[model samples]
Target: MQAPVQRQCSHVSTCELFPKFGLRGSLRVWQVFYCLGNFEGCARYRLSCEGRAVPASLLPNGRELNIDALVGKP
Candidate 1:
């Protein structure tokens, strides 16, 4: 039997939020749902494709992230 292919966002390596996702366990869900799956539905992916500025706080579900809180910043 053949192994199933895994689809991931092409910009994951360059994405600012990609690395941050690993810092918090809760953020992993976003990576699993968007970075590794359904990347086409990601807001960041869509913005990048359109040559627009993708905000670091933008989430795949079109929500803004309070990353500072997640990372213990003031």
Candidate 2:
């Protein structure tokens, strides 16, 4: 018999991809992977239209939030 798999979120409540806006607003890690299409593909995801790297956050328009100003020069 095959062993059962234990699926869990790697970055739940840690990563900045999802903000904690009440109970219904935040997203789980699985949701991030679902929207991203692949687990290993987030680094390549666009941080900004002007080409910049920033912390992860999703917008109401279904776009990645670019908070370079908030993070401020790594």
Candidate 3:
């Protein structure tokens, strides 16, 4: 058996992470990772996508919402 290679994306995206702002107050780098949000019972499975860099204050007003209300949470 062998490990598979990852894919890349050429666009920006918005995703939800737990405890809202898990990496708050910082800029992120882009990569492919599984998000534990964006679906019902989000953590059970993986939501794969490009892990684009986002800011802690990326959300409006820079305040961390309990959940990414615009989308939803895990």
Best by TM-score: 1
lDDT of 3 by residue, 1-74 (tens): 97765443222244433224345433221122323212322221222323445443333223444444424445
CA RMSD of each candidate after superposition: 0.9, 8.5, 11.7
Report the lDDT tens digits of candidate 2 across residue range 12-67. 35436434322233444434453334433344233443366544555423455545
Candidate 2 differs from the real structure by a C-alpha RMSD in angstroms, to one decimal, of 8.5
Error of 1 at 71 (Å): 1.3
Worst 10 residues of 2 by lDDT: 18-27
Candidate 1 wrong stretches, greater than 4 Å: none
lDDT of each: 0.92, 0.42, 0.33
Q: Candidate 2 overall Cα lDDT vs. reference?
A: 0.42
Query: Which rank order by TM-score, best down to worst?
Result: 1, 2, 3
- Residue pairs with clashing backbones, model 3: 28-53, 31-51
Give every collision pair in model 2.
none
